[model samples]
Target: MQTIQALNQGAEAVDGEGEARVGDGTKVWLHWRATAVRNSEGKIDYFIAMFEDTAARHDVEVAAEANLELMQRLSALKTEFLQSVSHEFKTALIGIQGFSEFMRDADQLDLNDARAFASDIHRDAERLDRMVTEMIALDHIESTRANLRLSAVDINAVIEHEVAVTKISAASAIVTNLELKLPKVSGDEDKLSEVVRTLLADAVKYSPDGGRITVSTSVADGTVTVSVKDQGVAARADFDNRLFGRDELYASNPIRKVVGTGLGLGIVRQVIEMHGGRLWVDRVDGEGSEFHFTLQAVDASLVTPGGGRVA
Candidate 1:
């Protein structure tokens, strides 16, 4: 029998009978009773005996903790709403002030410095736009807004449309490698395009100077890999665990220093997941990062293929 000392969630509490050891992901409640005992030298010490088999109590606590988590998420959502609203108001005010000042002192202001200030205002406004859009997107996903509008749209054409809309003139060079395919995806065309477009836009924002990003789509292992690969730092070795997160932006963009509110991926993830697909970030070792979202290639065996339900 293992000597009595202490036990916690991370460590195993060996059963005195050698039957089992507490393992990871085990739902357990731990309680200890302290009793005074005399040592051989007549000194007093506390002997703690742990009690187990409190499943009902543990379930009650788990439910309470889950409710607390829900409250916390709701609180966080409220905070995000307040901050986003304030940011939008501030951005509008700054734009008005900046453009008004630029117009009033057009002759005296140095053009370069004025342009930099203008850029800051522009970036903030864009940031606010992305934030608002993501909030709406998350809501829509949660609601599972019904739109099964399916069409025979060319998947390749949609990629091109997104690329033309989000052209980046940064030091990084955007190279697209989207190959053609057959039996177009039997799903909503507009929503799928948004997923690819947003992912590419993000990759461009985090790439290095003269960095290259390639967009590719192909069928492999009965799954389609719609990927946006950037020749910049992919996932930070330190923070790869939280890839589908925005608050981890500083970790992702360490050197080139791209500015982001860290909410885009959360939205992107929601959209991708709503479509009954897998979304993930893969690091390219010596290269950059590639975001590969997977979807069922086609429904050839099902013939009709109209029962597309979101899981």
Candidate 2:
């Protein structure tokens, strides 16, 4: 009423309290202005009013705000990942540098002592090399657009070969409980081998000097499951709580001081998922933890239309 009276008094006024009809006949918050025109006798003429709808613009602003918040979160995650990687790299370099210095200044040492220094230097160099290689592999696994090759693989053979070839055992015993008649599964052998190697390496590193590590396999319900159990500091609950959540970025925890790049399990998880499998942790009362993963077994139903079994 005040706006109408202002127009009647030969003045312009704005009415921004009401809503306007949209293209879909829905009402939205609106802004309007009225300008009164005068005739030659100075009497008020008809009024011209304009309205602007603000809902669409408001929606756009909201979406942009949400996207900005998401970007900020991603930036923070990138910073954290970089910091973790840098720390791991520096730790590896320290080992190499310290051992190299020891090997360089062993002039007065006995032959066995000099050989030991050389061995330590070589071990440190190997450690650094492993970290770099694993880092590259993690980057590839995370970003690669290529699809995994589906081939019939002997899981038992892959496990045996990986266990036999790995020399990282600091444990007193490694017990293998492999199923002799394990069925073939569709997977990439190399990636699966890496998974086995990563699990075994972790077990060896975490287990006490005389603790036992056990590798086992079983098949049921068209799935083959493999587990690596380590008798070390038990963190199964901690691991399970974060396995599918935010714990992926945590490089180390208070449970152990073992040296690692912290990307091995991440890569293992990626590879297992790529093969249409799942990985998990199982807590043992006094036997530490067991890491398990499952792969679909090759069944006769996977036979193609051409009567060829899926390989």
Candidate 3:
């Protein structure tokens, strides 16, 4: 019909491209051209239409476009990561330098003043060390080079210890709902403690208004699940998937404030995954966020009488 219309409009040929489904319901890209087969009288006698399947070429073009987009996204993420790292390092260095200079320039520093200056320097140094450590840890885990000293870990004990440490300076109220006598899991105690600490710290950081932060643990189906729930700025669902990504420090939401180098959660994820566990986050009753991770619980039947694994 289009060819006939074009011919009646005094066109000798017409061509276009579109999509169509073949007999097997397979979608295909098609390019069609119609030419007027005219007699000597210069009037169109019949139309010769040709169709070419361009599915392969179309697929290649689509793939190339997608690859280009992915490259651009990665380049942008790299730029963001470098900028964040530099800013964090500079802030820490400035504090350390200022405190050191104050101590060095004081004509007659009292014992108390010297001690306070030393403390500030130490704190800033620790912050710098932590950032570097997280970067190294993340790289090791991602490269499958992290050496986990796996053993039967008492998760409850680990959680209690971390909670006590967090309460030392946490502004938010810390709460625990740990299940007693939960089965021990096979993991690195220190790394698991780090995970708990990271989550608790995040909970405290996000809940700037001072709300309840709950740390809970439970066991089911040979798996031990640990979760940290916070009544803070609730992250939108669209940002959930990117929460654990290395490039994402905080959501783009204006209400969600960015802090640190944003490597904590990424490190937490790598550590958990390296220990053969899975990590994820969820919305807390439509008000806040909850971070969860699962570890493989040791089988009770496989334990010896002396609290050791059976060979």
Candidate 4:
């Protein structure tokens, strides 16, 4: 049975009934309640507190812990599968690259035909490599094995590098605004790279030929900011919560159009959190989506001449 009151004064909330919820953060104390009592004079006398029914809270906590354990196990299994897939694909890619190179050297097809075929092969190989790299990166971030060696990297430089690696040309006019003085943010380079890489990828994916993706960075007050804004249609008004969190083979909703494993954004969240940062997906006019993340910029003393902070 739960105790209704305590006979002693100076009773702590710990010696009470009912939970005391701490503020905006997360922390709960159970079996705690606080009350006050007065004497015959109606003046303040003492307080009464009781502690009871901790078993229910304990059961809930245990269930939550069990669920966490299950999720970790599932994540580990998925990591292994991704690694295996990457390895197999790598071997296949080598064979295909060899054949393509040989065919290019032989000059069997007309100039136009050869060029087109070679370009296709190159694109496919690059895509495969990107996929493998992303998978391994997600594995590292999820496992907390990512190094936090924060650097003051140039936002523009990073964008240029990733674009070069992906061979994505600035075909659209909107792809032009990647230059901005972002606060010399200090965070793990690998993790930050994953964030921007995913955002740019999604932007490129949803963007049509005429579409423009505005990648902007700005520093304000003391907070550093980075944003990937796409001209693609924002998410539907009816979209519930599947913006970047679906692991199933198909889209979870009827209005879903894109093909994805929903793993990218979730991994983004993990990476940001690991760096003590925050990430969010905002639906612009409920017609398109933009992804953003923020990290605390390191001090000037931590920065080098190139803007990347020293490890």
Q: Number of the top candidate by lDDT?
A: 3
How far off is residue 202 in model 1, in Å? 1.1
lDDT (CA) per prediction: 0.60, 0.68, 0.75, 0.58
lDDT of 4 by residue, 7-100 (tens): 3333333244445555677545567555657677654476565556576777678766755654574476466546655655665577578758
In model 4, which runs have C-alpha deviations exceeding 4 angstroms?
1-135, 163-170, 176-181, 237-258, 285-287, 300-311
Query: For candidate 4, which ten residues in a row score worst on lDDT?
Result: 302-311
Candidate 1 local lDDT, residue 151: 55
Tens-digit lDDT track of model 3 for 2-87: 76888878898899888999999988899888898888988888888899998888877876675555445444544555677788
- Minimal lDDT window, size 10, model 1: 302-311
Which regions of candidate 3 fall more than 4 Å away from where they truly are? 1-80, 83-130, 139-146, 243-258, 284-286, 301-311
Query: Which candidate has the highest TM-score of all?
Result: 2
How do all the candidates rank in terms of TM-score, highest first? Answer: 2, 3, 1, 4
Model 2, position 91: C-alpha lDDT score: 67
Give stretches of model 2 more than 4 Å off.
1-80, 90-128, 143-145, 167-171, 241-257, 300-311
Runs off by more than 4 Å, candidate 1? 1-122, 151-153, 164-171, 176-182, 237-243, 251-255, 300-311
TM-score of 2: 0.56
- Give the per-residue lDDT digits (tens) of candidate 2, residues 1-311: 78877777666554654556778998797667877777888777677878777777766776667555544533443445557668767766786777677767757667897777677667666767766786677567645414567788888777766776654434447767877667788898877888898898877766777777778888898999999888876564566734232233223534444454555676677678667688898777667778899999985433212211111
True lDDT of residue 72, candidate 2: 51
